[model samples]
Target chain A: MSYLKEKILKDGVVLDGNVLKVDSFLNHQIDPVVLKEISNEFIEYFKDKEITKVMTIEASGIAPAILVASHLNIPMLFAKKTEPSTLSNEDQFSTNVHSYTKNKTSRVLVSKQYLTPDDKVLIIDDFLANGEAALGLIDLVEQAKAEVVGVGICVEKSFQPGRAKIEDKGVDIFSICRIASLENNKITFVEDEH
Target chain B: MSYLKEKILKDGVVLDGNVLKVDSFLNHQIDPVVLKEISNEFIEYFKDKEITKVMTIEASGIAPAILVASHLNIPMLFAKKTEPSTLSNEDQFSTNVHSYTKNKTSRVLVSKQYLTPDDKVLIIDDFLANGEAALGLIDLVEQAKAEVVGVGICVEKSFQPGRAKIEDKGVDIFSICRIASLENNKITFVEDEH
Candidate 1:
């Protein structure tokens, strides 16, 4: 976790409007070494949960989520940012998510066939901002009558209300790196209180 | 390869319009075991190519591509389907690609910093249909002045012209499972040719 914190400080850019652009080695262009270590850390944190599957939203979250799933030897599912409905998508679970960064509302979808009532899913994502994406994923999983074991985040913007929002649902949440403040174009971290 | 072909026949659904829906394990909901096998097979085939980095498009391609990158201990870069030009996306390598299945066109973008002139890249993707996505990735890589070693695909619809289109560019392409036909509600496959 300290290494991830250091990595964020080193490669993460504190842009205007409080955006930590660590896309260099975290999201867009991924470093496998970092991802491997991140997965192991998450596994150690959530190992005893008896997680049946790992899930995340599309695009950015897939890289780390898949690595964690592979290490746990479980299946990984992603809710698509629902495209132009071209298939038999009638039996899907979907919820609207308002992107905090992008300033848009879009539907996140997962087939009911994938998330069953018996699954204990571990939700993962690249970043936790306003908790919109995580809440949307939890909605989809619960719609299938499945259980969300917990939520694992690569980076959490603690200044935002995302952590509080998810904890209100009574789900255990763990983040590898937590940015206490991105105020005045400076990245500051707070110790993660397990 | 044989296991992959068997998985296609067993779990893959043959939808209307030559659409082979392998969502049970390949994409959407993924089986990490299958992904591990696919990555190993691709690595074995392209081991001598001196691949410096593994690249793919976002969402579906990230799972398999990241696994390959982890096994090879290198970096993985993905071309984004591009949001509404939010950040400093002015300096990017982008090209438009028409989705063969979706019946639409979208621009794929990669940051100029990731794909460098010194890179010997290997492309990994989930499916190859009309070769639009693969070609778009190749276009992005070449725009950054990087060398493309080969293309690795999880499934290829041989009935389509994807393979031929990529081969026309003189790129070595390998697919784990080659479906010779997906007509009349049947999933038929042909032997892989090296």
Candidate 2:
């Protein structure tokens, strides 16, 4: 996590409206070397858990989730934001996710065949700001009668309501980098490692 | 390539509209073990090439690209289909891509900081039908002044104009599985070993 935090400090730009842009490496353009290390870190963190599937929401979270799943040698499923014509209507689970950045609520869905009662799912994402996406995945998992072992995130805004909302549902949250606050165009990290 | 062709014959479902859906192992739901094999296949194919980075488009392409990048111990960068809020205007190369499935054209962008002229990029994607997405990626790579070594595709529709179009541009294409045609709701492979 120190490596990630250091990388964030070195390249992450703090813009107006509390937006910490790590696009240089993390989300937009990925550094697969650093990304593999991050994936290994997640695998080491969840080494003991029985993870059946790694579930992530699309567009941004795919890279980290894929690496994590490959590192752990588990299958990873991404919930599609835009419904493809190839998808079948009979075997799908749908939920609503509100994006504060886009100021729109969109319905996200996953194929029901991917998730089942036998699954011990680990939900992963790039950022957990309001926890809306995480909640949506959890809903889909439950709909398939699967267990959400934990939620793994690359970055979490600790000052936001995301952590509290997820914790309220009795889910264990593990984040690589936690932001304490953003003040005066400067980014601050949470002091506690946990 | 044989493994992939065999996988398609065994697990791939031929849909109504010449669509072969491998969602069970490739895109929506990934089989990590199969993906590992795919990573090895890419490594074998591009073994002698000087690949500086593995570039891919977002969503489905991320998994195979990450797998190949990890196998090669190189960094991977994927193009963003939507404009991420964290990205800065100072560090991005953008291009237009038309989606056959969506019936719309959109601009895909990658942070310019991650790529450079010295980099030899291997473009990776899940499918290569009409070659629109692959061409979009090639455009972005060229815009960054980077050399595209070649393209790696999971599945290619040989009956379509994709391979010829990409090859006419002088870019070598390597497809794991090439389908000759899909007729009578049956999948027919042209040069597939399986």
Candidate 3:
């Protein structure tokens, strides 16, 4: 985690208290160098686990997931944000995800062909806030009867409830950069608890 | 391109006559191995060009753009699909794009700060169909007074008008797979002339 903890994305955007924005490395532009390191960090953190598949949501998460999955030599699954395909709901594993940033809720779908009861899933995402997207991914994993090995996140707002919510589900999390606060346009990282 | 012309995605999904679907490498799930090859192909084709940024539309193109950008050690910019941010339309280069797959037209926006007049951008994407997405991306690059070095596409339906459209804009294109026909659920690759 310290490897990424030392990194500053978008030169670390300065936003007022309680509003965190790290838009430079993702959403708008992604630095492959940082993302490459993020993938390696996730691989290093979750290397010991028997990760069968690396799962993530579409748009932002797909980039990191691809690097990690490729390095691990595992298939990367990204839940589609598009309208469910012609395949009935039974043929797909889906869940409702509410985005705190955009303030909207959309149904995310993953084909049953990809996720199954045999997968030891490692969920990855660009950022974690309120745990909405992560939870939706876990829901889809659960619906497939797959085992959730743990979740790998690039940036986590430790001040938020996302960590607790995922832990409540008995899933583990390894976040590279843990933000303790973003008040007064200053960035602070949570000291490693370990 | 012959190197990739031999690769078949999703075992070449069979659907009778003209309708082509490649949901395996991208959109739903992205095979890192294939994407890695695609990135190398792009690097090989455009290696001589001085590319400042690798640009692509969000949701699907982000994965390839990330890989290509990282391999080249350049920044990757993905146009956001979300509603334009508070950055007045004047400050953002916005365009209306119609997705034949989704059958809907929505605006895609790119911040003005990232794209600049001095940029030599290499546009990348997962597929090329009617060329609406490609054309929209080209428009955004042009709006910023940036030079479009070329377009790198993973899969292109050569039978479609996308190739003709992009070529008409005077932008070079390098597609790994050029499909000649998909009649009778059988896949055919366009024979290389050179």
Native contact fraction per model = 0.86, 0.93, 0.79
DockQ ranking, best first: 2, 1, 3
Q: Which ranges of candidate 1 are over 4 A from the true structure?
A: A84-87, B84-86
Q: Write the per-residue lDDT of candidate 2 for residues A1-194, one digit (tens) a residue.
A: 47888899888888888888887678866776668767877888888899989999997788889888877778999999888787867778999999988899999999888899999999999999999999999999999999999999999988889989999999988998899987787888998865
Tell me the TM-score of candidate 1's A chain: 0.96
Q: Which stretches of candidate 3 lie over 4 Å from their true place?
A: A1-10, A84-88, B1-10, B84-88
Q: Rank the candidates by lDDT, best first.
A: 1, 2, 3
Please list the residue runs of candidate 2 whose C-alpha ends up more than 4 Å from where it truly belongs after superposition. Answer: B88-91, B192-194
Better of 2 and 3 by DockQ: 2
List per-model TM-scores for chain B: 0.96, 0.95, 0.91
For each of the candidates, give the backbone clash count. 0, 0, 0
lDDT of 2 by residue, B76-139 (tens): 8889887777676776899999887678999998888888999999999999999999999999
Predicted model 1 interface RMSD? 1.6
DockQ of candidate model 1: 0.76
Interface RMSD of each: 1.6, 1.5, 2.0
Query: What lDDT score belongs to each candidate, Candidate 1 first?
Result: 0.88, 0.86, 0.82
RMSD of each: 1.4, 1.7, 2.2
* Best-fitting candidate, scored by TM-score: 1
